[model samples]
Target: MAEKLPALAFGELTDVVRFLMEIDKLKSIQRRTKVLGTDRQENTAEHSWHFAVAVMALAPYAGDQVDIFKVLKMAVIHDIVEIDAGDVLVYDLVARQAIHSEEEAAAIRLFGMLPDAQGKEFHHLWHEYEAGESAEAQFALMIDRLMPVLMNLHNQGQSWVENGIRLEQVLSRNAFIADVYPALWDHLKNHLDKAHQSGWLK
Candidate 1:
């Protein structure tokens, strides 16, 4: 005698499915940073995955002891806002600030697509990461800023050169990395200097 399967929960399943379908747009939402070692531009989905990968590899090097899992969660969900708000370039300070309010609104709508409990959990992580106050948030934020710096260094300052960005602009935008994660910041600075001297970074 075999057990019979239960009837599907269509309403609950429908909500979750909708949320999954909505987030799929992240794959198509492109960022300014290109894929390292590749000529192709990176999308928001790839950026989120790479940020999680960076967190996994660099967790032990965090400036302060942190909840690694929370940091990972933060990295994964932080950019879900890009689905509605879109990716803002690091150098676009005015535009970046302009989108802050819209991003907060988008966070509510996108995460709200999930079930109530799940949506709140996601919004919390997204908000925490934006605040960058806690140790985990600080470390997660550090990676967000560092990854683009590394990409430009490897790509002969691809985006910087394309956009005519200067060294002061790059350093000014990334100063928080040094303030929070000094060691990683030092490593970035050394590569940045090499990038500048090599004429890759202006």
Candidate 2:
């Protein structure tokens, strides 16, 4: 008799389908740069990649002996929910909070699309980033703060000026970075002060 092929498990097949579907969602995030004179939108995948690299490059300064690997994983996938929830600008505090549950729902729907194990792994990571608990969370949050700061500085605070973002608000929002990563904070603060002096923070 000819050899017979083993049957595939339904759960495994479901996982494969889930993974394939989730990959497509990565392209949905879009961010516009008012500061850089560029109106082009950036996808979530690109933003995650940049933040991941930022985490690696700045890992040496992480707070409380962070695990670089965990931090990397967290950065790489933190904003995936934006694929569904959309990128809420940091300056829009009221809108940002209003969408918190919306983003959580997005997280559940998107992360649940993966294989069971992988789905849980990513879901946990997303929750960790949200909770801001571990050293990894702290560092991930710092990088989250840093990328926009650098982008704004490079573009002469275009986003801030366009949105009428105030210096006090910006300072308060970003100050948590100092607690987790002082060196990064120092660098950002210097630029911020310059932006203020240059009439970028009116």
Candidate 3:
């Protein structure tokens, strides 16, 4: 037999439910990377879920001991702001900088929908990811940046080709991955070399 769980107070339940409903909007926010083996673009919600899974899978490769739970939380909440700011290409320096304020505003507004304690936790996790200072944040950020590259690799550099992205650009943008996980960076660079030689990248 299972133990019965305590129920939440009515107000708390309402706030939690409203926050859940609000974050559902994240699914509608499309990203530049297409889903593997599909023509359709992935959504922010899908990316978050995938990121969390990748975090779990890649946790062993992290350079230092990390709180897997904290990293997973960071992955899940990091992009909820995209529900308002929309997805920007990782390679787009100008557009990425332009939306910094909008993304921060979106983060505050969306996370503010939750009750205070829960909201603060979400905000902290999101900001930690943005800062990328801690070991967990670095691991999480590495995976976050790696996923689209993986997607592009599997899909024959679809986004890179479409965006006219050069091999140098991809390397420059994602070189920080080496600081977190050099082995992963080496493996990725090898594939990227093949990709460039195959003429998938400009």
Top of the candidates by TM-score: 3
| Residue pairs in collision within model 1 | none
Each candidate's clash count: 0, 0, 0
Query: Please, what are the lDDT tens digits per residue for candidate 1 over residues 69-174?
Result: 9999998899999988998888899999999999999999998988899989999989889988999998888898888887787788888888878888888988
Q: In candidate 3, what are the lDDT values of residues 152-181, reduced to their tens digit?
A: 899999989999999999999999998888
| lDDT on C-alpha atoms for all candidate structures | 0.87, 0.80, 0.90
TM-score of 2: 0.85
The candidate scoring highest on lDDT is 3
lDDT of 2 by residue, 55-154 (tens): 8898767644799999998987788788778888887889899999988998888878776788899999999999998888988988887787787788
- Using all chains and alpha carbons, the TM-scores for the candidates as numbered come to 0.90, 0.85, 0.93
Q: Which parts of model 1 are misplaced by more than 4 Å?
A: 1-11
Higher-ranked by TM-score: 2 or 3: 3
State, as a TM-score between 0 and 1, how close model 1 is to the true structure. 0.90
